[model samples]
Target chain A: MVDSGRAPRRGRPPVSDEQRGRQRLDISRHAVRLFAEQGVAATSGEQIARAAGVSERTLWRCFPTKESCVEPLLTKMLDAFRTVLHAWPPGVGLIEHLRTAYQPVLDSSSGEDVEAVLAVVRMTHDEPALRAAYLVLRERAEETFTEVLAERMGMPPATFEVRVQAATMNAVLKVAADEFARETVGRGITPEVLKDHREQLAHALGLVTRRLSGTDVG
Target chain B: MVDSGRAPRRGRPPVSDEQRGRQRLDISRHAVRLFAEQGVAATSGEQIARAAGVSERTLWRCFPTKESCVEPLLTKMLDAFRTVLHAWPPGVGLIEHLRTAYQPVLDSSSGEDVEAVLAVVRMTHDEPALRAAYLVLRERAEETFTEVLAERMGMPPATFEVRVQAATMNAVLKVAADEFARETVGRGITPEVLKDHREQLAHALGLVTRRLSGTDVG
Candidate 1:
């Protein structure tokens, strides 16, 4: 068995990565619904666990704090942005590239997922815990932004200017997203409203990064 | 007594605003010191209370979370910036105004106060709890920034563009401050180093706000 290509598993087999991801998403969906229906302060871990059909122990293992239950959803949004940025072609304008590539992804994303994400974002306005979770995830994405921006600008990722640009870019995007989500939460997020948000984000990002060499073609 | 200049006093005499401010500052100093000596995770509320010569109840009343002990200092910094912005004259460049008016405030501030503030800012890098406190304070200050920028730009404060600029400005300042604090924490803060920080901040702010009519004269 030691010489075989596949090594013998120890004890019980661990949960597969896809299963873990699905579980997290399920819990995040339940947590977001609870948070939206009842305020984050009124929602508890047990309630969330019950709603998600998971035990308290499993919930705690998956997320350390009740506030952090939204991480998987937030991370998914950030990951999409990062993926789009990584695919951004050199010599193409950032806004144009995002409109071309990122817009389709947003259009294709399930309405339920988008609504959950918007609800979480909308809740961040009043809930400090949720806001912190959101900010921390956004902060983590800044490094990825810095690297991509640095490559495009021919500067080190750690350079003050490059880092500042990356941070400003993220801040503009975040503020725009927050504003859109806040305004669109009460009324349903129509395709028109979503398009408006995308335009607003692109416009803000373009204005902030206009001075950078590889960012603005306009 | 109601007709008289002095109204009838209720129950026990309340603590004076000055006294409350002093008490908060003292507790904050102690908390910052302990957090610096030992990591934030290792420091307890009781230890902070003891170090500050206050009861745990009082400490809790002053700061709900142990991480929020730094709010007093952070608010002081933001208040200074807000004051400077309010005093800023139209037609004057932002960076030049800061250099002329703000530099003196920094110069006159006690070294100990500066060190404590820097220590708190530096700690925000690795400590998620502390980082949350710091970010929340910074987020609050965005309103002041928005108001100032809006007045100068002749736009409504709540306008999306104005708000985005305000958020971006705060993000740039925060990133710069964190960087400066991280770099200067080990070596004692020097006047030269302080000036360098001011310049870096002004420069970064200028770069981000260059396109705005009221912010950049250059």
Candidate 2:
């Protein structure tokens, strides 16, 4: 809050929305790359600051901790999912909407950003601190899914039926994302592999939905 | 890491397995009370150490963080659920097993433990740091449920179907507990209300299973 008042504006006056998003994404990718190369414990905030090409002060201003540097990246992923989720029309089934939008959601992010996200996620499989950050991001995503599920099913988000459905959907999506990351993120993703996710998600959702609720909205 | 050598444990030779559990529960109740009464931020580990009648060193030994002081109380509630989930035989449906086990689960914990757990969980609805801890507990519980769901359904524990069902059941259980806590813990629990939880849980599970997986085992 302090030095932003007088640091002498650099390159486009605090940046446009697009420019800010680019900066955050760029910083996250650099932070995640360093995290992947070196474990979370060994990685320092100063290292992250240098890797991200921001002043140490700016880095701290953006992220309270080195672990939190991954959060904006996770938020980018969450935002993509929410963008797809919130646009659902009542007539379309959840899985159907998800299947159609799934490719676009991942495609929306640049390759560097996607690689950074997967690196952070892969780290979460082993890192406790990062897992905490990852799960909190997921909790935020779950809230979005919960609200949408409530609306779609005509129930309060607090009600057991809606909540279970939402939580289950969130689980399904996480599994889908994890699987996709495992298969393609490091090896390189193709348009074909991306489309394959549509089928995988649909089948998983369809099986789970039939087992969970007999009614097929689609 | 700590010198228990100097402070001489006051009660009954450092407690038996059963007594150790009681001591932990007692400490947690005091911790939760101070957390609720004075606020988690304002409440000091020294204060908890004083109230629970343990050395400052012992408090640090027991709980790595002040917030984690709630873990034992949460574990008591989780243990009850796992005891119910684990004992499911091959023939019984999930809901039937849950209904039979629900009453015994709550009856197992002391009133103080139950209230402490409820206080922590209610605070989770508003507190970010505590909510992360609370969700982590649920994640642990979900792992337990996943194994049970896999066994009951004759699937691998890691399979998508089993994972989704387990996560959904976990969500349903959280909702039931939250609803139960809001209704009874503050006002005081009654036999009628406590017994009614079986009905409440049964109803939630029945609706969810029917919605999720239509084939009833019972």
Candidate 3:
């Protein structure tokens, strides 16, 4: 039987997943700026579309609601961490991998992305929908951590130890990143400071992993 | 100079703090019942007063808004873990402390309080105000963890290691508790099974502490 799920051949080829994702993120960036400038309720779909240089129909096609506009940007921030973890080399200590591979993203010229992240954090403080979105992202990150952890330790993801370790690690990273974001906004702390935070996070994760696995990975 | 903040009394008041707290809790219990039955927006300060058998003015004096009526119940549930941690003995391991102290408060002979706690959880899913209040409680709980961890490790609360470790532990406890709540609602998991999640939590915390301190408590 033909797989109906597959994209149908048409005059214009379907947008690649990567292109669709970029368009979604483009809309999110515009939506965030609008949401930040005006309140979420005051912002209109047309305004976001205008800002993103896309048609209103295109914006709606990408996001069901204006509140959901934050998802792509938020998801990208989380995916950055997940990408690092996925690329982590086996037998290399967690701390070393984080310090060496993770620091460049924050320090690169793409500092505007860091500012976008801060806007989401500020929005979460007052916007319930955005806060819920942020929490959902966090839950997904925890699952990713659980999978990576289970693979590293040769255990099933459902194992109690793996779940607990994943939860602990998730909590640490979240709290640390939150504090870092706050500092970045309130005290003008640079992303470089986050390097030290990453090291501490790695140490915290290492401790939990060692205890759960009954072997030290550090 | 007389200290303005100091208590001005020849002797202590007739009602103890515990008695006052119980009285407030009673009012909160009735208010939550009305809120759950009639909905928060439909319920009013005057109606809550009548249900709790108190004056409307008294209800206002206690809580600023109708939504906050659930705070007392929500705070009590969140405080349960911290109260246990505060009473933890030095010789006991973290896991043992949790298992021994955590009883199924819902299964106790007092079934009314169980209903109140469940109502708060159910409301949290829909009520934005309640969700914000719930998050504030979580933040307080994390602070409590930080204090306990700092004391245990003989480090100042401002210490980087202490903060990171506390964050990880807080995350683990939150995820485990969240899972327990979800499971209890969806799968009819008993309190006994929920309590079993604590062992994994303790193991997670144990690993975090060992990694940070370079020594095992158990």
Instruction: Write candidate 1's Cα lDDT for A34-133 as tens digits.
Output: 9999999999899999999989999999987888899888778777778888998877888877777775236336778777888888778888888878
Write model 2 residue lDDT over B42-157, tens digit each, in one string.
Answer: 89999999999999898887776777788878888888878877776666666776666777445557776677777887887776667777776777778888887777777799
- lDDT tens digits by residue: candidate 2, A124-213: 878867776777778778888888778777778877667666666676677777777777755677788778776777767765554223
The per-model lDDT (C-alpha) reads: 0.82, 0.74, 0.71
| Candidate that would win on lDDT | 1
Off by more than 4 A, model 3: A5-16, A35-50, A53-68, A104-109, A122-132, A182-194, A211-218, B1-72, B90-92, B104-109, B115-137, B154-158, B182-191, B194-200, B211-218
Name the candidate, 1 or 2, with the larger DockQ value. Answer: 1
RMSD values, in order shown = 3.6, 6.9, 6.1
Q: Identify the runs in model 2 with alpha carbons over 4 angstroms from their true place.
A: A1-26, A53-60, A155-160, A184-186, A190-196, A210-218, B1-26, B53-61, B191-197, B210-218
lDDT of 3 by residue, A1-218 (tens): 98885866668777799999888988888899889888787899999999999899988888866777988877767777788888888777676677677753453326676687777887787876566556655766778989988888788997767777777777767766766666677655455667666776666666555643223442
Worst 10 residues of 2 chain A by lDDT: A209-218
Q: Write the per-residue lDDT of candidate 3 for residues B39-95, one digit (tens) a residue.
A: 776888899899888899988887766766777776677676777777777756666
Looking at candidate 1 chain B, the ten consecutive residues that score lowest on lDDT are B209-218
> What part of the reference interface contacts, as a 0 to 1 fraction, does candidate 2 reproduce?
0.31
Q: Report the Cα lDDT for residue A97, model 2.
A: 73
Question: Which rank order by TM-score, best down to worst?
Answer: 1, 2, 3
Worst 10 contiguous positions by lDDT, candidate 3 chain A: A209-218
